[model samples]
Target chain A: MLDLPTRHLHGPGPSPVPPSVLEALGQPCIGHMDPAFMRVMNEVREMLQQVFGTENEMTLACSGTGSAGAEMLMDNLVEPGDACLIGVNGVFGGRLTDKARRAGGVVTNLHADWGQSFSRTLIKEKVAELKPKIVCFVHAETSTGTLQPFEGLADAVHEHGGLLVMDCVTSLAGRPVELDAWGVDAAYSGTQKCLSCPPGLSPVSLSERAMEKVRSRKTKPNSWYLDLNLVGNYWSGSRAYHHTAPVNMNFALHEALRLVLEEGLEVRYARHRRVHERLKAGLETRGFRYASDPEWTLPMLNLVSIPDRVDDEAAVRKRLLLDHHLEIGGGLGALAGKCWRIGLMGHGATDEAVDRILAGLDAVL
Target chain B: MLDLPTRHLHGPGPSPVPPSVLEALGQPCIGHMDPAFMRVMNEVREMLQQVFGTENEMTLACSGTGSAGAEMLMDNLVEPGDACLIGVNGVFGGRLTDKARRAGGVVTNLHADWGQSFSRTLIKEKVAELKPKIVCFVHAETSTGTLQPFEGLADAVHEHGGLLVMDCVTSLAGRPVELDAWGVDAAYSGTQKCLSCPPGLSPVSLSERAMEKVRSRKTKPNSWYLDLNLVGNYWSGSRAYHHTAPVNMNFALHEALRLVLEEGLEVRYARHRRVHERLKAGLETRGFRYASDPEWTLPMLNLVSIPDRVDDEAAVRKRLLLDHHLEIGGGLGALAGKCWRIGLMGHGATDEAVDRILAGLDAVL
Candidate 1:
């Protein structure tokens, strides 16, 4: 039997889930097709729509982690020979490109520097040239802790006759995610990030036009388990049965959404911003710098450049874990070892958690 | 708020978890990389190995549902232009074929009737002809409750110089899965089925040969999250922390595996078989016939033909929930509404549960 250690999760996602959500997770398992469980599923779907700010009827949680949702959406939306315009500014953006290519879509990438937002000018030019069926970008890139503003990108895509898909994995609960208001045709988010829930399910919603494409697909969905057309039938539309869902995780997510709604979306966004502001002040006081531009940083995830003298990032991380029971993330891909990503998501973004991380870094530095 | 109706789950999966496992789920969330939590992860990995009957160093739980594991293995193992062979006996087998093809593999499938086992001779011939990179099959088809015996299929695969991957999602805990002894190169299982854990993580293991292929891949895996080379870092050597694991779900699984091991693997296997036998007797007494062959049926999941008079499978299912508060699974894909899948699995396979289901069914019938 494994016992959970007492530690403050200051790393990205798998944040400190509220005790209420944990209690919800322990509730007894139910059949996915059970009327009562389906009822909960319906409420979860509605709540997810509220959070995502979408009226898309095809909204439901994919039975996997965040990236699986990405793959599921891509698998159905993009097919062989279809051109896809991908905005690659971080690891997750790179993933969308990879998934599209694997699905036989011809991927055209609009590259951006890691920890940087997409340039609308460059995207508009690419859209004009490639004219892809779907224009995909990450709203909040978890790897680089950068938020890409797409306030007008969707309109650009629509003008070019392409639908917009966004990755809201890190932004869904922490900030305002107006899927419909922002004209996002398709989007996916993880439960573990700002939701203050354990990582497992990925909530996805698709616009009516996107739903039509899925319904009238040129080919059968390759992955039957995640074939959203059929999955949606189970989730909605008469509550048809599919595979067994992660019942307890759904329970946890439902409770997490309840908390998010209870706090109100605005309050949740404010909480994230407040903690990030305090943490930023403390880090600046400690002479640390950030990787992402101040204007584009995610409130819940802060990726900062490590000081030159911090030769061994792993050692520093180990020290933090041993001395302060604080867990932080090291940079990935090209940024590996150069930056530390400190997260203040959901229950983790508190004054005490922020102070402890700063103090731990101070001791190590 | 959607209230969960109190129900007895005898469905194919999302099987009713033990109260202990349920209690474990509600425990406070911990950081995935927390040292104590890593120890818990280590226990889960080791116990998974014990259950899998493998010494594969790469054994770890992927933080997704069973289908995600299937997608992960397919993405990592198969690439563009790679040839693969699959035996299609039920929905799962067909889904695996779809997954393989979606990952850009040129798939050749040998079809078997639903609720029927494969002929090793035919598969061996196909193996000789196709010479595929991967030969895949389902050990236990949950939809039809048919157990396909490997027999000499593995040796044939190795003889043809192909790696054999088995979907043990419905077989692992309920049956004797001797992975190393049987020469299976890679395999995946779900926590929700025979393990009696909630569905969030998929336990997967790979042989040394499979790991070598993963290490030597020419292209980056299509799905970044499911990529074994990267994910293995989080689960094994690199411990690089690829993604935030579903912390509490892992705790629930660790405890579930402990319960599995504490009872002794053979004892647990026998317990599942014993409960299945009792349930089968009860179902037989009620004049219900199993869809699968008697010799090839999986004990954990029983696929029974619903009576023709029961025109409304959905209504019966609804009535079961509303009137009796018991849950069972309807058929999927080709088997939809034609049959019902009843599960007798870990903790949920008690004799009392069997009696309750029988009584409930009698009242409904």
Candidate 2:
């Protein structure tokens, strides 16, 4: 086996997985249809409901990464020629637009600056004008660390006769995501971001409203592997086989969800907030500035502008990884070479990790 | 964490993950774009080339299970109204037809009885008559334990100006699959079967002809996550960011491929055959008959007809799991409750494993 170096993952995702979850992942493999594994799957579903703050029965993990969740939602929810309006604030929203268009939706792209969130007024206006069947946006945009406010957007979409789909890839476990309270019709997340698990499975939940659209679709979902109705049947009590579940990955996710519940959502969210403040203060003292607005910034992913004196962003990142054994994400797409993304997610959102990253940046910069 | 029982996995797929691959999985999580991780990816691609006996540049692992690879290939290769012919002898072939139809292909499914392989003459006739854009079939049908021969089918498809896609999910690491020699345009496999890794990613390879088709597509693939063009960019020298890869799962796959190369493909294939023969002989002595034809039965998965005395198939499988701590698959689809699928794949194809399973079956029966 190849010898792998230990890394303190402060990157945009795959944030350091905890040892307990790793142990769970390394457990002996089991059959996907095994009774014991089915029990584990049920527990995972229940825990995901708790974490998502919803009573939706169709809460389960897709067998791929977070991007699979995005494709699954778009492919199943958006039918041919269905008018869909999307908030294109960051890379993820842009991705949604691409997926929606490919799924044959008449897509209306609403643009926002790289580091900004979509205003509710703009979304409401678009919903009224476009009369879209689905209104989609990201809850916590990973590309730009923006925490979009989603309080009345669902109501706006519903009033305009549209379902609401939210990409909560980076927000699910680390923040308050009240799906029912926010009236979200559908949402998706990843395990690696705030769940302190490896990136394999995507946890997705869809409300009755979203399932109704899927049930009444004129054509089947374009991707059979990601057909939520078929996948849901397997994940539901019927347990009909769709495809072989990633057994060990499910084990890891179950443990990760357990850890999240053990810490409690409120405590975990407060911890993330507290660590972000400390890191913000430390970075400011070192002459670094955040790229996103303070009110819309995500506590888990801190997007910061690259200092003017740092001539080589890649060099600084390399030095940090090589010398300090740390990993932080560089900018992507429009922000490439212009900013840095320092993630404080799940296990990585700790005081020690923040101190190490701060010290590493201080030494490298 | 839940205390999971140690199981001897003899299922149709997810045969058994070796200790080394499991150890690799438990290693510290790293960034997907980390230089070290990139090196691992490169090595995995090279090793897959050796295993598939092809130098296709597009060979890489998909971010989901084996079925996801099927979706990816069909979604990318088949555009709307594209003529596609699929051989449906077993569950996997039927699955391909479903995925192709969902991808908007004009599908012509050629049917065969369960536990049988498609004849090359029939495929050639179908290709010539249908004038399909793509011809698809499964090489090793896991559900039926039939190894379909590929002696002249590729030539037939190529002669008719059609791209040939093969599903090698259960054949790649355990059997001889000459993609270049057989002229297969595209093929895909799962890690868990003979690669001795968990089921989280699918290893896919596309010939130049396949990539050319993908490049010249008029419309984008429906499922963005499974689009090979964008995913290939991330796997290629460009190393563009597509999505967050399953970092640790890739690590496990890399280690598993290393083990396959170390054993060498010829030797591994011979071992699978030898163990399978021994298990078959033992089962025959106990009055169990094989479901598949003797000429086309796969070495990895042995589908056996339950004896008349054995009234309850589920009861025997449950007893094997509960009493013997062994796991085997029951029949699926048309063969449901009529047979059992005992696998001898990768790490689970050892003499000790075969002996233990036989003894366990004897006790349970």
The numbered model that scores best in lDDT is 2
Highest DockQ: which candidate?
A: 2
Candidate 2 lDDT, B60-128, residue by residue in tens: 999999999888999999988999999999899989998888788999999999989888888888898
Residue-wise lDDT of candidate 2 within A77-122, one digit each (tens)?
9999999989888899989999999888999899989889877888
Question: Where does model 2 exceed 4 Å of error?
Answer: none
Mind giving the per-residue lDDT tens digits that candidate 1 earns over B47-149?
Answer: 9999999999999998777887888789788877889999898988888887888777999988989999987788888999999899999999988999987
Model 1 agreement with the true structure over A26-119: per-residue lDDT tens digits: 9888776666677788889999999998888888988877877898888889877888999988888888888888667889888888999977
Off by over 4 Å in 1: A219-222, A308-311, A362-365, B79-85, B104-109, B119-133, B213-222, B307-314, B333-338
lDDT of 1 at B227: 80
lDDT of each: 0.85, 0.91
